[model samples]
Target: MQPVLRQLPAGALLFHRNAPAYGIFRLVTGRVRLERVTPDGTTVPVHTVRPGELFAEASLFSSCYHCDARVVHDAELHFYPRTALVARFRGDPNALFDFAAGLARRVQGLRTRLEVRQVRAAAERLLLFLRLQVDAGRFYRPEGTWKDVAEEIGLTHEALYRALAKLEATGRIERLRGAVRVLRTRPG
Candidate 1:
């Protein structure tokens, strides 16, 4: 089945929490942020989907979306209907296996993020998160501000600022206008 194409302007809410799960989305261009709002009205960021990545996969089997997905930039996306994809997977073992593998990778990423957030030291958490982002090529030209990163890493924005300041003072990273560049250490 042909995936349906969608174009959304920045700040558009693709779906809200508890909404029925119609399909999963593949980001062809631009960025998307998945977030959940707490009962106290706090917004907790879940993940940021970049180009070429599929998001909301968990919604495929679920009745509803676990979080709200919003466009962070003007975006072009392809919506793959869950029902159609499941039907195809039933007839194709290779397709089912590949889809499972992608879901496994996403689970592993979330596990690693959980471990990083468990670190008691805010600086350590920031450093680890930054390293992970750098490894993913998402650090240098970050899609959102440090505040958004703080939410993703489960830290307060003030704490993130403090950690960045410490890292900057130690010359571990260079802070540009809207980016953070990790500096390479010289071997003695």
Candidate 2:
């Protein structure tokens, strides 16, 4: 089946929690955030899907979405119907293997994020995230705002600002226009 193309603006919801899962999506551009609304009515961010990434893969086997998928930036995506994809997977062993491999990698990344979130100190948490996620030059470029990075690292926006200030003051990191350059591994 040919995938359906969709264009959505920021704040548009692609799907709601408990919504029937008909298909999976591949983001061609922009950002989509997966959030779970708690019993207390608080929205908790689960994950952010970037361009070139596929989301709601579990929907291929599940009956409904586990969380809400909201567009955080104007986005373009391709929707692949689950039935057709599953049929292709069954017929193509290699396709199934590749999909499973991608899932495993995503799981590993989630584990790392969880570990970073478990750190108590905001500065320490931010430092650990940079250390783990930075490129070879030890620079971590945020895909969104500092608030988004704060959310990803399980810190309040104020706390993230304070942590960045502390890190910069201590000469542990350099805050560039759109990136954080890690000068050291730990607070000095």
Candidate 3:
């Protein structure tokens, strides 16, 4: 990974429209807010990328950032330059495979964005967001706060807390010390 260090405050933009595509970043700590604005000036917040996720990969092939990426909370990232990434794939087939996997994940993230936009009900949106938050059948980080979940599901913090409590009380998740454990869902 290309080594770049920056400490951004909440809502600090990491990338802007037409910004140079220097590299891809691996989240080391904190939260990143993915935001896109429509031509009509409507802002759509896609999600807050957690640690262990990659952001701004679109810059790899494109010359400019298509949207804005901001930090929802303080964050640390490892930036891998575009040239280094391109070179890695050029040398080994496995590197190419890894790149493909990463690209696939970006596509899935976009799909989730579309789904969120399509759903009309906030409750449904919250449920879908929670489901996607799972990794390998478990919540990725129980350390996530109600604010994180609220932003992801596009709900108010109070509403998110209520929704989460409802899910928890129903045995869909268990509230732990610092995280919530996802209980298995029933097959629809």
Candidate 4:
């Protein structure tokens, strides 16, 4: 089945928590965030879906969404119908394996993020995050604002700013327009 192409503006609500599950989405461009609202009315960010990534895969089997999906940036996306995908998977073991592999990679990334958040120092946490995310050339391009990154790393915005400044001052990292280039692997 052909996926439906959609364009959504920032702040658009794609789905809500406990809503009937539709299918999965592939982000061709822009960012989407999955959040869970607590009983006390606190919205906790569960995950940020970036371009070239898929979200709501679990919805294929579940009756309802566990979190709300909101478009954080102007987005281009493709929605794959759940019934179609399920039928495809049932007929093709290789397709199922490929999808499972993608999920495993996401799991690994989450583990790395959890490890970064566990670091005590803001600078150290930032460094570790960069180390894990940077490419072979030692450059990391942030998908969202520094504030978003700060929250992801379990630091306040002010602390993240200070950490960035410290890293730059110590010649550990160089800040580019939308990226950070790591100069040293170990903090000096």
TM-score for each candidate, following the candidate numbering: 0.59, 0.70, 0.60, 0.70
Each prediction's whole-model lDDT (CA): 0.87, 0.89, 0.75, 0.89
Clashes of each: 0, 0, 2, 0
C-alpha lDDT (0 to 100) for residue 53 of candidate 3: 84
Candidate 2 residue-wise lDDT, 46-81, digit = tens: 988978888999888998999999999999999999
On the 0 to 100 scale, the lDDT of residue 6 in model 1 is 98
lDDT of 4: 0.89
The parts of candidate 4 lying over 4 Å away from their true place are 9-12, 36-45, 71-74, 134-158, 171-188
Question: For residues 14-75, could you state the per-residue lDDT of candidate 4 as single tens digits?
Answer: 99999998789999999999999899999999989978888899998898998999999999
How far out, in Å, is residue 51 in model 1? 1.7
Write candidate 3's Cα lDDT for 17-44 as tens digits: 7888877888889889778888899889
Question: Candidate 4 — which pairs collide?
Answer: none
The best candidate by lDDT is: 2
Instruction: lDDT winner between 1 and 4, please give it.
Output: 4
Ranking by TM-score: 4, 2, 3, 1
